[model samples]
Target: MSGSEPAPVEDRRDSWEGPVPIPSGANETFWEATLEGELLYQRCEECGTSQLYPRAVCTGCGTTDPPFETSEGVGTVYSYTVCHVPGEPGFSDRTPYAVAAVALEEGPRLLALLDCDPEAVEVGMPLEVTFWQVSEEAAIPVFVPR
Candidate 1:
């Protein structure tokens, strides 16, 4: 697993009203790693494919238990949307935020909140991962300009 130093962190546990993730099944390790300011993805040792949204079974090969890899936490914006209207619960106060599908350098894409003014985002903009510790069980990945 290749990684840089632990990324920046912003503790949102006290103020977060959003839906906190409850780690279960294969994603437990993924969520656990977030607290340490690390981004994890699954890479199939058998087929050499990388994927996000950790799963018990590998997507490329039917290999059970693909190994985990730590990301460098750097990526570029693949696509994005500026939401003027709140899309999820607890986000009403955060209307007009940018959400992006970030294409990680490690070859997996992750959907995350882009932590900046919505107007500042651009396609292909370079980003680095950050974590918002929303709960004791998990933290959510957020991105910002690199």
Candidate 2:
């Protein structure tokens, strides 16, 4: 799929036993966008640095409240790990999952769950974002093979 297309959405709310994100502060906007199947990153207009895990101050130039830009939702796997053990609560049943640091086409990288068979993942693998709705207000981004 092309970068401009909306990422696919999966309704996991009924089965989600994972930790749910509570949107607040700078994260409020990011989480809100996710509910609509958009992945957003902050871009500093002053220094042109893009960042994820939204913060009030820009990492590049100390600019306050950097403007957000929607990502193309396509990325490359920069790095990854396979979890044989549950690292977080409620993930015991989902052990042997993959987590990856995905480098988006828009410049920022996101650490997200790679929702695919662990044995199938590799560095430099092309991926696309998808959301798993865990709550009414938030959905976590998950990446899958493109």
Candidate 3:
């Protein structure tokens, strides 16, 4: 190694495929549940509003804190897009895949990969949560036709 040489850039694509932002103060339970193949969300006890990207405070009423519960892992495609371009690394082999924002029956929308034939997907299509183990501590939730 020399001062004139640049350091090799590290690759982090194997960990996550997109902007994987986990909201502060509210992801421990959700990530823990994912390890067990379950999905979870927070529901405001003060006001019956459910939300994704879990938060410590309720987005509706600004409550000090909110309660959380496990979800059934069932949802419907609220919206989607067929990606001709590889949005993230490690996904070039899976080109032309569908990414969707699915609205869960319990009432929170989550963005995830849609695991089905691209031609078979449509808005409002039934879906169920599926897990993709990306690391020892994280497993992403993808969706598949139900």
Could you tell me the TM-score of candidate 3? 0.82
Ranking by lDDT: 2, 1, 3
lDDT of 3 by residue, 12-34 (tens): 44755654435335677776666
- Higher-scoring candidate on TM-score, 2 or 3: 2
Question: Candidate 3, which segments miss by more than 4 Å at Cα?
Answer: 1-24
lDDT of 2 at 128: 90
- TM-score, every prediction: 0.96, 0.96, 0.82
Model 1, span 1-146: residue lDDT tens: 12568876679999999889999999999999999999999999989999999999988878998999999999999999999888889999998899999999989998999999899999999999999999998999999898
CA displacement after TM-score superposition, residue 79 of candidate 3 (Å)? 0.6
Candidate 2 global lDDT: 0.92
Root-mean-square deviation per candidate: 1.6, 1.1, 11.7
Q: What's model 2's TM-score?
A: 0.96
Question: Rank order by TM-score, top first?
Answer: 2, 1, 3
CA lDDT, every prediction? 0.92, 0.92, 0.75
- Stretches of candidate 1 off by over 4 Å are 1-3
lDDT string for model 2 (1-146, tens) is 35567777789999999899999999999999998899999999999999998999999889999999998899999999999999899899998999999999889998999989999999999999899999999999999899
Pairs that clash in candidate 3: none
